[model samples]
Every structure is written in C-alpha cells, then in structure tokens.
Target chain A: MLYIICMVAGLLLSRALRLERIARPIGWAQTAVTLILIACMGYRLGSRPDFIHELSSMGLMSLLYCIVPSVFSIALVYVVTRFLLKEKKNGRNRDSW
Target chain B: MVILALIALLIGTLAGMLAPHSGMLAVLTNATDIYLVVLMALVGITIGFNEGIVDKLKRHTLHIIVVPTCIIVATILGGVVCSFISGYPMNISTAIAAGLGWYSLSGVTMTNLVGAQIGTITFMSSLMREIFSFMTIPFISRYMNYSSAIAPAAATSEDTTLGMMIKYTDAEHVVVSLLNGTIISAAVPFLIPLCLAVF
Candidate 1:
C-alpha cells in the first residue's frame, strides 16, 4: 500500500511540477538512488554467512528453474506478437495493418 | 548505464551469495526492486518531458490498445502452456507474471497467497523474461515499426534499457511505450495481489 502510494505520489509530483524537461537530470538522480539501494542490499547480504551455503545447495537446478520460465515467456511473447498477431513490420516494409 | 546495472547485479548477487541470513538476502534482493522503480520513474519523466502526454496520447492511441491487448492474450496462452509444460498447477498470479514479463510484483503476491516455491519460480521466470526483453529489443525492433517496439519497451522499462529505447526508437513510440508501460506497471502491484486473492 505504501509502495503504491509512493509510486503514485512520485508520478503525480513529477508531472505536476513539469519535471520532464529536466528528465535526464532526474534520471541521474534516480540512478544514484538505485545504486545506493543496491549497494545497501549487497552490504546487508555480505554481512550474512549462511546465505552462501544455502545458495550452493540449490546449485544448477536453481539456475535452470529461474531461467526456463523467462525463456519460455519471451519466446511466447515473440511468437504471439509476430506470427499470431501478424503485426510484424520491419523498417523497410510499412504495411498498413 | 548497462555496465553500471551489471555491476549492481554482480554486487547484489555476490551479497546474496555471501549473506549468512536468508532475511538479509531477501532485503538485498528487494533492493533490486527499488533500483528498478527509481529507474522506471526517471524513464517515465524523461519520456513524459520529451513527448507531452497529449501528443503521445494522440499518436499512440492505436498502439496503446494493440500492444497490451497482445501481451495480455499472449500471457494467458503462455500461462496455460507453461502450466502444462512444467506440469505445475496453474494460478492467476503466475499467469499474470508470465504475461507482464516481470515477476517482481506478481511472484511476491503469489508467494503470499500460494506458497514460497511457486513465488520463487514466478520470480525467476519473470526475471528471465525481463532479461530476454532487454536483450531482444534491438533485434525485435529491427523488424518492427516504432509503436510495437516502443510500447513493450515502455512496458518493461528498467534502468539500463529504457534510455536505449528512447535514444534509438521513434519519439512517438517512446512516448506511447512509456505511458502504456506506466499504466500496466502501476496496475501490476495492485492487480497481482487482487488476482491472487480472488483466483
């Protein structure tokens, strides 16, 4: 709930203020925040010891389990968007669909 | 920017690997979401600034309808196929996650509603979908017009990728993509939970 509110607030505030022109600058700021957050996450993780053992225990199956759905989803999106929708338009050929 | 993201991912992964407590690792993992949101917000602002909402609406009305419609349809089909292929019981959250091509919200929601294992699978799969989208955008766009490419690009905005889409793709498409993506992204957090609860 709070997350949703923050997102909505940020979006509304940014729009209300006409912060679009300075988007790149804002982007940089957001990027900085993201970096810091990621760093904090990493620091927190590094401070723990048992995480390594658990991750190792999962091993190759973990990688496969994580990767398979992603591959399948992308393939599905591509095939459906391309062949099924028949909306495939390259740069050279602009067909009026 | 891509390099920076890769560095962050590496650092996060390393931290997760090194952490002793699962709770600490979870915090680190959640940080990725924070990073993603901030990046997406900036992407939205940049897109909004470059292409005013009114103009973007006028330009991409068709695309806005077409892309999400396609994605939703594709997601439903994909979920069914995934359920059958994986031999796992299908549910709404997994379907939506597969459809949205990102698990961050849907996976977590499913976990809360269903169980941790399913949630983990959804997250992994959705993460893969995001990575795949990032890699294939250029190749896919090569065969697509501005709108189709832009809509999904906007739909899947991340720190490293949205800027590339904007820089390389048509302005109208970028605007449409951003707007469309923002709508879907916003809905995901709420809708995923609702879907999980209801179904």
Candidate 2:
C-alpha cells in the first residue's frame, strides 16, 4: 500500500540525512499537509452521490456500531491504565493520562 | 483542526448535494490517498527522528499496545453480538467486525465472500466508523484520555483518521496511533478469513 511505503520513506529520510536544522520545518510541513488532507477528505464525502441516502439509513446504524464499541473499549482502557499501571515519573497525576 | 474538518465536510457536503454531476470523485479519492500516504510518511519521519519516542514507548507500552488490543477484541465482540441479535449468521457478523473500520477493503472482501447486501452494510459500517472518528475525536479528547480517543477509528487511527488524532491529541499520540493501526490492520486479514471460513 502507498500508505506503508510513504511512512517507510519518511523513516528512511530521517535516517539517511541529518535534517537536524529542518526538523521543525518538516513538522510544520506535516501540519499543513494534514490540514489539507482532512479538507480533501471532506471534499470526497461531499462529492458522493449517495451521501444523503446512506446517511439517513446505514449512517445511523454505523454510528451505533462505532459508538458502542468505542465506549466499551475506552472504559476498558481507562480502568486498565489508571488502576493497573504504576504512576508515571511526570507529576501531572490523575488530571492527564 | 476539528472545527476546520467539520467546516470542510459541511462545505463539501453542500457541494456534493448541489453539483449536477462530477466524474472526479475517483480522482479526488486517489489524490486523498496519496496525500494521506505522504502525511503518514511525515508522521513516520517524526517518529523515526525522535529518540525520546522509544523512552516514551517504554513507559507507555502497556497503554499504547494494550489499549488497541482490548479495543480490537471489544469491537469484534460488539459486531458479532449485534449482528447475531439482528439475524445475521455468526460468521458473517464476525467477518464484519473483523473489518476493524477499514471499510472499503472489508466491504469488498465481504462482497466477494458473501454478497452485495451484507457487503454494503459492512462497508457502511466501516465507513461510518471512520466518519464517526472525525466527528468524535474532539469530544473524545475532551472526555477521555488522549490515547483512549483512538478507539473509534480503530485501524484508521494510523491512517486517514490520523489527522484528527493529531489535531485532538499530539504527535506523540499520532505515533502511537500508527502502532495501533498497524496491529489492527494486521489482524484484519487473518480475522476476516478466519470468520469467513466458519461460513
């Protein structure tokens, strides 16, 4: 997949070159690209012919599918991480995980 | 960025609703894929470059790795249970959950193995999973631990859904998401076929 390749390329780039001076710049570029990608995603969804048809129907079901499991999993992770793991070195404490 | 994405989706939906017809959705889809791939690379570079990431991983390995493992199991269970109650056969329901929110691949796989009707449902379900991530990341970040926010997107927590993760969480979570996605994505191939085999 192009997805894996691109990420591997990035890792390769990081290794083969210093890029030390431009690390921050590269970060900025990543931010910009991410913004553009999100917008483009919106564009594709908007362009779909069946967006509304599906939305009122399967969309709602899909939402239920996503919500229930996500809620259950998050709760599970919260309990496991908060109670099971020892506290971190940073003293941010219970406020942030 | 969540607001930005929301606005963009709104504008895009309006555009999609208004347009007479367009032949370019396919092209845009490919472009988005390429663009996202690039973003993934950039994210990888950041991770590859960050020496501290390993240390962070050592500290948070349990959190980073185990969270997704738990989520994968929970999601599959939810899918199997819901589909069974709704009348689908056991294998089909399990296969659908095995999708892990990578809708297109899962949908097509189901279509090839099952049929259009269930395939479409699986596709819609997975697609909604991704869409739901966009809508929920901001809220998830607010209400839950940043990493727990990765749950809904599931496999896409590493890919297309990643921008929202970066927006709501941080680059650090972004890296963790890549790991999370990799693990879930790897599970998909084995899980889908294994479920389908039961059919």
Candidate 3:
C-alpha cells in the first residue's frame, strides 16, 4: 500500500515537473514488474507439495471454472455497452456520464 | 516500451523456468507488480496534467463514466450467470478477482485466499480482459466518442491507453480515462476480494 502511494506521488511530482514523456517508460516498467509478480505467484503455487494432486483432481472442472466466469464477464460487458449506449452520427458513442 | 516490458517479462519467465530453486525465481517474478504500479502512476500524472484531457472530460464526462460502468456491471452479471450455469457455487470473490486485470495485486490476493488454481484463473481472466480492452480501443473509439472508449481501454493500462488515445483520438478522453483508471484501479484490490467473499 505504501509502495503504491509512493508511486502515485512520484508520478504526480514528475508531472508537476513537466516530465510527461517519462510516462511510457514508467508504464513499460510497470508491465514488466507485473509479469514478474505473476511468475512468482506461479512458482509459489507450483512449489506446494499437494498442488499437483489438487490440480489433477480438478481436471476438467478447473477448466470449466476458469472459462465460464471469464467468457461471461466479457460477453456481459459487450452486450450492455452495445445495447444501452446510444450511437452518435458516426456510429460512435460518447463515453461520459 | 511495451515491447521492452514484454521482453523483460519473457526473460523473467525463462529465468523462472531454468532456475534451480523456485523461490529464487519468485523474487524476480514479484518485482513486476512494483514496476507496473509505479509506471501506471506516472502515466496517470502525465494524463492528469494534459490540458486537453480536462477539455475532453468537460466535453464528454457523462459518456466516459457511464460506458465503463455498464461494462463493469455486465462483467459482474455475467460472472454470476456463468457461475450458475456451470453448477459451481457463484464465487463473487472470484468474479471480482477476474474483473481487475492488474494481475499483480488481485492475483496474489486471491491466491492467498481461495488457492492457486482459482488465483490463476483470475489472473488469466484479468489478462484476457486487459488484452481485449487494449485491442478493442481503436475499434470502440471509431464507434463511440474517444472518451467512452477510454473507460474500457483504461481498464487494462491507463497510461499506455491514455497515451494512445491522446495521440490518436480526442485529448479530453485521455484525461478522463486516466482519472477513471486511477479510481477503478484503486478499488480493484479491495473490491475483488469483497466481491469474491460475497457471492
């Protein structure tokens, strides 16, 4: 949490200093970090002694669990955005309130 | 820059694969979250300071906020429906986990709570969400005002998308997207877990 706060503060300070060009570099850095975090989490998961057995037991059920929520969320978002939002002259919708 | 980050991520994954000890690789892996948050904040500040961002927000604040809200709501509803259809108890915690693709935080948090497979599912789902949002931004913008596109686009990477939106679309959308991303990202850590616990 403190780390996040420091990061936000640093960015704000950078912006105040007019260093807008640095944003992309910073963003790329963040992406790299996020990937590492994911890998670490994977490693931790893989290291557990029961993990393989648990995974095997999960089998097809695991796949279903994963796919169902994901597809549903994306489809839901798409449907609502498409149906509820009014289209403009260009067939584009405005993105405000 | 995204390319560079991707390369770095590739290298990290490879290192993890090749390493003798898993924990050694885990340290390297965990670094990505810190990098992402800092980078996102920097992107946010840049967008926040842009004059055109404010102008765009003034022009289309309503569209910007509402569209993303609709998308998020849809995501939640879909999660619920899928849970029911799959015969798995609806796990709101899991749905919330999938909703925030920030991966580093939400993924870890879910792992600590629900176990790894579920966490992996959340991580992958979130990644998909981000990628989908990123790839669709241009197409979405063509149909909607840039501000509206910013909402979902920023759902993945505020800084990267905001920059792209500013360069390619309306300036006002860039600022509004940044602001919106900031707010949503902040909520993700807590909301995902809460939602997971609820359903």
Candidate 4:
C-alpha cells in the first residue's frame, strides 16, 4: 500500500510538473540507486556464514530450482502475451501501452 | 548497466566477506528497504514522464493482469516438476518456488519455518532468480514481446529489475512489470505458507 501510494504520488506529481528536462539525471540516479541496492543484496548474502559452502553444496539443486521456474514463467508469459493478448512479434514495444 | 550491476555486486560481496561486521556495510544493507521504496517512486516518475502512459494504462486495465498470473501458475508448475526430478517433497518445492525472486524474505521465512537446508535452498534459488533476471531481461526483450520480459523478473520487477525493464523495454511494459511485481510480491508470503500447508 505504501509503495502504491508513493508511486501514484510520483506519477501525479510528474504529470503536473514539466520533468522532461531532468529525465537524464533521473536515469542516472536510477542507475546509481539500482547498483547500491544490488550491492546491499550482495553484502547481505556474502555476510551470511557458510555462504560459499552452501552454494557449492546445493548449487545444482538451487540451479534447478531457479532455472525451471524461470523457464516456465518465461514460456507461459510469452505464450499468453503472444496469443491471448495478441501483441505483435516486434523486437520491442515502446508504444505498447 | 548490467556490467555495472555485476561489478557492484561482486565488490559488495567481497566487502561483506572480508568485513562482515563492518558498521558501514550493516548500515547500507539495512537501508535497502528505504532504497527500494525510493526506487519505486522513481519508477512511477519515469512512467509518468512517458507521454500518454496513463491513458494507455486505462485501455489495458484488464489485460495488464495476464503477466503476473501466468508467472505464478508457471512457477508452481515448475516447482511440481522439480519435485518429481529432485525428489523433494512437493510442498517444499512449491514453497521454495513461492519465493518468486524475493530472496531475503523467503530465506528468512523459510529458515524460521522450515529447517536450515530448505531455507538455504530457498535463498539460493530465489537469489539465482534475481541474478538470472538481470542477465536475461535484455534477451527476452529482444526475442519476445516487451511484456514477456517481465516474466523472468517476477517479484523483482517492481524495483530491483525495473532498471532492466526501463532500459530494455518501454515505459508501458515497465508499468506492467511494476504491477506484476507488486502483485506477486504481495502473494509470496502467503503463497509460501499456503503451499507448505496445502501441498
């Protein structure tokens, strides 16, 4: 709920103000923030005891757990959007909305 | 962007391993929640800057839901297959899949509820999902429809993977990615427990 509210507030605010001039800056900030978050995630994971040991031991199992679900998700989403939503097979859909 | 993210992750991991007790590392790690919230708002602002996105949003109100639903169902089905192949209990397999790329929460939750081994699997698998999404979003955007790019991302699409969505896809798909992530993220906690109990 908080996330939704913040996003809606941002959307409304940006729509009201002419924010185009700062788009580049915003993109750069996004990149910085994203890297920071990823770094933090890495820290959390790496700081855990036996992190490497666990990864080496359960690597195959974990990989299976990750790969199968992602594959299924990608396949299903593609099929549905392709056939059900009837989206074009173009390379990208910048104006898809 | 992807290369930079990988480098950031590597540096952070090395820092963490070397100085696990560093006050600075702890503060930055703990502040991630705040950072995520800000990122979401920024995502909204980015979308808003795209002309006519709101109107486009309205036109596809009903259709926008298709992405997340497919992801949830497919993930569960994949879990079922993993159960057969890996010989783990269906309940545990599905519960792990229910993490939906939110590794931290799922890891802690499973650690508390289940045993450490299962928890580790949950954490590692979900973490891999996130890392894989980071790598695959570009290819998915190129080979499939823009909306399909959000599939691999699952719950991370809202914040962590939004960068990929913004760069590889367009504003409209970013909206879908955000909505899909929020819905799945909301479902993850309940879904994990529900799968454990019911299946």
Calculate DockQ per candidate and list them.
0.27, 0.34, 0.28, 0.43
Error of 4 at A69 (Å): 0.2
Q: For residue A54, what is the lDDT in candidate 2?
A: 58
Ranking by TM-score: 4, 3, 1, 2
Model 2 per-residue lDDT tens digits across residues A1-97 = 4556766787778877856557888877876665554444445455556666656665555555566656666666555655665322221153443
Best by lDDT: 4
Per-residue lDDT for B1-199 in model 1, tens only? 4356447645855665565456855664555455556655654454445445676667556556665555544455555555555555555533444426444445444444554445444544555556656766676667654444443332465333566577666555555566666655665666555545554
Considering every candidate listed, which one attains the maximal TM-score? 4
The deviation in Å at residue A94 for candidate 4 is: 9.8
Residue-level lDDT of model 3, residues B61-154, one tens digit each, is 6555664565455456656665665555677434533455564556655665676666655655555556556676677567644544554443
RMSD of 3: 5.4
lDDT of 1 by residue, A48-76 (tens): 45545544433332344334443443455
Ranking by DockQ: 4, 2, 3, 1
- The DockQ-based CAPRI class assigned to model 1 is acceptable
State the displacement of the C-alpha of residue B149, model 2, in Å, after optimal TM-score superposition.
0.4
Cand. 1 Cα-lDDT: 0.52
Better of 3 and 4 by TM-score: 4
Candidate 1 has a TM-score of 0.62
TM-score, every prediction? 0.62, 0.59, 0.64, 0.65
Measured with C-alpha atoms, the lDDT of residue B120 in candidate 1 is 44
DockQ of 3: 0.28
Q: Candidate 1's chain A scores what TM-score?
A: 0.70
